[model samples]
Target: MSQLIAPHGGHLVDLLVPEAERDALKHEAAGLPGWDLSPRQLCDLELLMTGAFSPLQGFLGRADYESVCRDLRLADGQLWPMPITLDVSSEFADKVAGAPRIALRDPEGVTLAVLEIADRWQPDREAEAQAVFGTTDRLHAGVSWLLDKAGPVYLGGRIRGLTLPPHYDFRHLRLTPREVRAQFDKRGWRRVVAFQTRNPMHRAHLELTFRAAQIAEANLLIHPSVGMTKPGDIDHYTRVRCYEKLIAHYPEQTSMLSLLHLAMRMGGPREALWHAIIRKNHGCSHFIVGRDHAGPGNGADGQPFYGPYEAQELVALHQQELGIQMVPFQEMLYVQERAQYAPADEIRPGETVLNISGTELRRRLHEGLDIPEWFTYPEVVSELRRTHPARHKQGFTVFFTGLSGAGKSTLANALMVRLLELGTRPVTLLDGDVVRKHLSSELGFSREHRNLNVQRIGFVASEITKNGGIAICAPIAPYAEARRQVREMIAQYGLFVETHIATPLEVCEERDRKGLYALARAGKLKEFTGISDPYETPESPELRIDTSEMNPDEAVQRIVLKLESLGLIRPRD
Candidate 1:
C-alpha cells in the first residue's frame, strides 16, 4: 500500500519486455525494416517506454493525433496536451507499407524496440501548428521545426521495448517514473513538488523553488529537461554542472535532482499543461508553473506568442483533474536594503529590489564582467565561465557573402593573415572555389545544390568555431534562407559575424577576374547569381563593405574593427 499519487491514468505503463523476451525480440528486429530515430524522436520514445508518459503506449495514430491537436485530449478523452508522433520519410513509409512491425534503432544502429504499426498517414502540419502552438509563424521555434525538420509521414503503433535508450552521461540522475516513485517510497515522502527548467539555476531560481516547496509543504524535485530545448539555450552539460552545484545548497532531505529527456515543443500554455501531466506521472503531487512556461519568446510580429500568466492559468484550471496541485512560481527579487530575497508580491513599495536578466548575465559573461555574488553561486559561475570564456578568448566565424568578383575571397584572405599575425588562435580559410573543389565537388549550381554547398561550409565552420579556432568563410550564399540557416548553426557554438561585400553588380562585372560575368552574359552559364538567379542582399549585416569604394586592405580593416567592436578581438591601442 504505497501511497504516492497514482501514476497518470491510474497505472504506470511499463513497455519494456521481460529480460527473457528481449533476446528473442532483438533477434527478430534485426531481420525487420529499421528506422533510425532522430534526437527528438528518441526522447519521445524513451519517455513513452519508461512510463514518464504513463498514458501513452506508443506514437499516436491519426485519430488520437487529431483529438490531441484539436482539444488537448486523446481519442478516449484522456488529457494529453502534446502529440507523441513518429515521423518518417516518404521512402521509409513506402518501404514499410503493410508491415506488421518495424525495428526502431538508435543512431548507432542498435535495436531499441519493435513498433507494431497500427496506423500510418500524412498529417496536415499547418492545422497542427495552429492548434498546438496557436500560431502558423515559422519564427516560432516549434512551428519552424514542425514545418522544416519533421518528416513527411507519421507512424503510429504500440512499442514493444527491448531496452531503454543508452545515455552515457548523467546515468545516475536519469531515473524512470517507476524508479522515481520507488525513491519516494523509500524516503517515506508523499507530497513532492516538481520544478521544470531548461536553463541554469541561479540564486533567484533557488529562492523561488525553495519558497514553492514550502508553500506546497512537500519535497522538491529539481527536474530539468535535458532533451531538445530552444535553440541558443545554454548547453545541457554546462547547465547540469550548475544544477549539481546548486543542489548542494538546498536544505538536507528537502530536495533532489533528476533529469528529464523531454523534447519540449515550447508550446506555452499547452506545454504547461503537458508538463503537469508528466510530473503527475512521475509521482509528484505538486508542479510549478512559471511565467510563460515553455514559451518560445516573440512571434514574427514581435508580440509574445502567449501571455505571461497564460501557462499558470491553464495549469490551474486542470490541476484538480490532473490530480496534482498547481504551484504558481512567484518572481523572486533581492531586496538590497533588507539583505534578503522576497517574492514580488510581498516586497514593500520602498524596498530597493535587484535582479539580473538572462540577457544581462550573458552580456556580462561575454565581456568578462563581474557577476555579483548575490545573483549566483561561485561554483555555478565557474561552470558557466568554463564553457563560455570571454568573447576574445572564444572561437568565432567571419562569413563573407556577396556577388562574384566582389573581393570576398581577397578580403577573407587578408583577414585570415591579419588574425594569424596576432597569433592568438588558429585561423582556417574556407574559400568558395577552394571548398567547391574539395568539399562540394559533386554539388551543382541549382538552388538546392547551392544551398547544400553553403550548409556544408557552415557545418565545417561551426566545427572549427567549436574547437576554439577561427574560421573565415567566403561564399556567394545569395539566398537569405540559406544564410540564416548557416548563421543559426555557427551561432550555437560561437559568434557568427556576417560581412556583406555590398559591391555593386556593375562593379563586380567590370572586375570580371574569373570571366564568370562574360559567360553569364553569353547564356553559357545558367542559374548565375546576379545574372539569372537572385542574390538577396542581407538586410542587416555586421559590416557592409563596398569593394568598389575601398581596396581589399581597407575592407579587411573594416571587418577587423567590427570584430573588435564585438569584443571578439582585442582593439589596437
Candidate 2:
C-alpha cells in the first residue's frame, strides 16, 4: 500500500523533510535535480489550479494568492498559451470533451486565429507546442502575460478551436470511486455505484442508471466525464446540472451526484483501468464499466483506439489492482415495449421506444421541439433544452460522405438551400474540392494527401458546428474510417449524420459525370475510389440516401426526416 501512493526513492522522501528544505527541493526538482512529474502528477497539479483550486491554492501558494486566471496570451494578440489540462499527459487523447476554446478573434468577433491544446507536448515542450499551437512561447510565460480578450477567457478543456461551441466541454471531467464514496458517506448513504458514460444524459442513460442502482441496492452516482468524450458532447457543466436535475426523480435518500474532471487518453482498456483506479480513489465501492468505457474512437485512417469489450476486459483483469468492486454492465439498448432502457439481449424482437440517441435528442432540443417523456423525463429534457437551445444557439454542421461523382455536392447544396429556407442559422458548405484547394493547395491526390484533406474539412466543419452555424460538407470521404473519424469529430459541435450516398459504383462510374471515372479507368486518375483503389461503405450510416433512386426533392425530404430523427429540426408545422 505504501508503494501505491508512495514517495519515490532519493528525493521524494527528502523533499518531505521540512519547510526550510521545501523551496530548495522545489527549485532543484524543477531544475538541476530534475524531478519530472509523472503525467498523472502534472495532471493533478493542473486540476489543483483549476478544479480543486481553492484547496490547492491554500496549500501550494502564499496566503495572499487570491485565485487563478485561465487564459494567457502572447504578443500577436492571440490567446497564446492555450490552456493544457491533464488529459493529454494521461490519456494522450486527441480530444477533450467540453473543453472551452480561446477564439482568436479581433474586437469585431471575426476570427483571425484559433487555438487547440492537445495532451502534454510529446517531445520537448518547446518544439511540441511550436508544432501544435504554431508558436514556441512556453504556455506558462503566455499565462503570465494574461489573455487579450481578458475577463476569464473561459476555463475548461478544449474540444475545437474558435470554430467550436461557446462553452468549453468537460474535457477533463472525472468522478472517482473515492469521491463518490465520500459524497455518499457525507449523505449517510453507503453502497455507492457509478454510472459511466461517453455521452450526455438521455432517457436511455436514465433508465440504465436507475436499474443498476435498484438492482444493486445502492445509491447512484450519475458520473460522467468532460474528458475526451464523444465528439459532439454536451458541455460537462450542463450535463452535470442535467444529472443534478434528474437526480430529483430518484429517491432523494438513494441517490447522490457529483462531477469528475479527468482527461481521456483514448487508450481503451488502459482507459478503463484508469477509470476504475480513479473511481477507487473517489471512494466508490462499485464502478460500472460498460461495453466501451472511455472509448474516444479512431478515424478511418487509424485502427480503433481500442476494441469493443476491451475496456470491460481490462477492468476485469485489473480488478485485483483496484480498491473498488466492479459492476460489469451489458450494452443497454432502449426497449420500445417498456419504453425504458434495458440490456440489449433483454429486448423482445418487436419492442421499440422510438429508438434514438443523445445526439438526436440534442438536435431536437436545438430545434425547439417537445421531447416526449417516453424518451426522457421532462425535467431532463428541460435541462438539455435550456443548455443547448439548438437552432437558436450556435448551430452545428451537415457533413456528407460518399464517393466521387456520387452527387454529395449536389445533395449538400440541396440540403443547404433547404436549411437556409428554414431561416436564422448561417450555413457553410465545405466541399472536398474547395476544402482541398484551401488546405491542401500544395499537395496532390495521394491516399495520405486525401486523408489530410478530409481531416482538414472535418476540423472546419467541427468549428462551424461549434459556432452553431450549419456547416455542410461534401467530401467524397472515401475511407469508411476517415468518414467515421470526421463524423465523430464534427459531433463535438453538432450533429454528424453520415449520409451515405449509396449510389452504386456503376451509377458513379456511369455519371463519370465529371469524366473522372473514365480517367481513372484509363490511369488518368490515381487513388480514385472505386477505380484502381476502393471505397468502403459506412459500417452503419445514420441515414443512407440513394441519389440514384430518389429525385433531388425526395432526397431532400429524406434528409429532412433524418434531421428530424436526429432532432435537428422540428416537424414541419
Candidate 3:
C-alpha cells in the first residue's frame, strides 16, 4: 500500500468544535439567533464538520457561490463543482440579517453549529438553475425543489460545529470520513475504488463495481447515500439491508460498506464530479462514474437533460485535477445461456441475453412475478418483497373528485360498501362533507384553504395506504394542480386511483342533492365550484363516471373492475 490520497483542497479541514471548547461555544450560541436546520442542511453540516467536504469550511459565501454558479470552480480556482449555500425565508433573513453569529440547531433544538454570518443576499435562483442544472423546468426534481422548497434568501458564513446530528439507527454502519480514512490506513488500503449508488444493487451493479475495483487494483468502498434521493426510490433501510446481503459475495477485507449522508441534488454531470471529490476525501483513489450518473431522469419533453455519456466525459475531463481515477461503467448484460454477466460489447455473436430494467423490476414486484436469481440474490429479493408486497396485497387510495352535485359521495359510498364486503383489506371512507365537518372544521373556501384541506385528506390516505388499508376519499377538489400534488404525495407509499365523476353541470344542478348549487347560483356561496370558482377537468383519470349514464352501483362496479385489472385487487370468486 502506498500513501493515501490527499483531501480535495490539499488539506483536510475538520470544523468540529473540540470537546473542551464545546461548552463555551454553547454558552456563546445561547444568545444568538437560531435556525432549526432542515434534513438536507443537517447532511451538509455533517459532511462539512467531518471533513467529507473538506475544502468547504462552511456554507458558501456570496463570492464563492457566484463563482461556482458561473464556473464550476471555487473563488480561489479550486475545482469545486457544486454550490453549497444556506437558504432561508425572507422573514428569517430579516431576523438574522445583522446578527454577528447564529446557531444551527437540529429539530429537537440541540445546537449543532454556530455560523459567523459573513454574507447574506437574495440570489437569482433562475439563473443559478440554468447555469448549474441546464434547465429551469419544474419537471426536474432538483429544480422543482430549488424553486419551490428552498427559502427565498441565501445565508453564508464559516461554521464552528458543536456536535454531529444524532443517528439512532445504523450507528455501527455510519462512519465519518475520518473514520473511513483511518480504517483504510489500518487495513493498508491506499488504492480504494468507491461506488456511489442510490438504488438497491442488483447483479448488474455488483458486476460493474467488481470489474471497476479489479481494473483499479483497489479495495472496494460500497458508499451509498442514506439521505434524500429520487422521490420514488426504495427507502434507505431496505436498500441497506439489500447491500448487507450482497456484501457476503465479495472477498473479505477487500470490500467494506459505509453509509453516506448526502442529500443528492441529482445534478447529473456536476453531481458525478461532486461525488468524486467527496470520495477522494474519504481516501478513495478511484471513483466509478456511470451513464447518466445521479441524473433525475427525463423532463416533460420526454428527453433526458444530459446525454448518457455526459457524466463520464465530464469526470474524465477533470480526472487529472481531481486526483481520483475515473472508472467508466460499461454496459453489462446478463447472458442467459452463459448464466453470467458480460460486457454488452464483448459478448459473442448470437448469445442469448436477458436484461431487467428498473421499471420492469418494479412491475414484477407489483404483480408478484418472478425476479430471477441471476438478476439479484434471493435474500435481497426476499427483503424487497417484505417491504414491497404485490399490489393486490398492498393498500391503496381511491380519490373521487367532481362538481358539487356530481354524485361523488354517492358512488364513493357504494365503492366503500363493496370493498368492505370483500373483507380483503381494512377500508376507510373519507367523504368530503364528513371530513370537512371533522378534520377541517374551521377552514374557509379560499383557494389556499381548499388546497390545504385536500392535502390533509391526501396525508391521511397516504398513511392508511402505508399501513395496508384502503382510503376512499370523495372531495370536490376543483383544482387539477392540487389533485396532482396529492397524487405525488400518496404515490410514495401506495397506489393512488384518481376517479373523476364527470357529470355535466346541467345534470348535477338538476339533481341538486345538497341544494348548494342554488346557493352558489344566488351568490350566497362565493367561491363554489362550477359557479364562481372553476373546476379544472382532469386530463387523465383512472376511471371517469357520469351518474347520468350509470347508477352509483354501476360506477362502483366499473372502478372495482379497473382496480382488478391493475393488480390492486382480486375479483371475488
- Candidate 3 residue 508 Cα shift, in angstroms, is 3.0
Task: Give the per-residue Cα lDDT of candidate 3 at 526.
Answer: 94
Residue by residue across 445-549, what tens digits does model 3's lDDT show? 999999999999999999999899999999999998899889988998998999999999999999886798899999998998999999999999998888899
Instruction: Arrange candidates, best TM-score first.
Output: 1, 3, 2
For all predicted structures, in order, the TM-scores are: 0.95, 0.49, 0.94
What tens-digit string does per-residue lDDT give for candidate 1 at 452-571? 999999999999999999999999999999999999999999999999999999999999978989999999999999999999999999889999998888888888888899999997
**Window of ten residues with lowest summed lDDT in model 2:** 6-15
Question: Cα miss at 57, model 2 (Å)?
Answer: 24
Q: Clashing residue pairs, candidate 3?
A: none
Steric clash count of candidate 1: 0
lDDT over C-alpha atoms for residue 131 of model 3: 89
Judge candidate 3 at residue 374 and give its lDDT.
90
If both were scored by TM-score, which would come out higher, candidate 1 or candidate 2?
Answer: 1
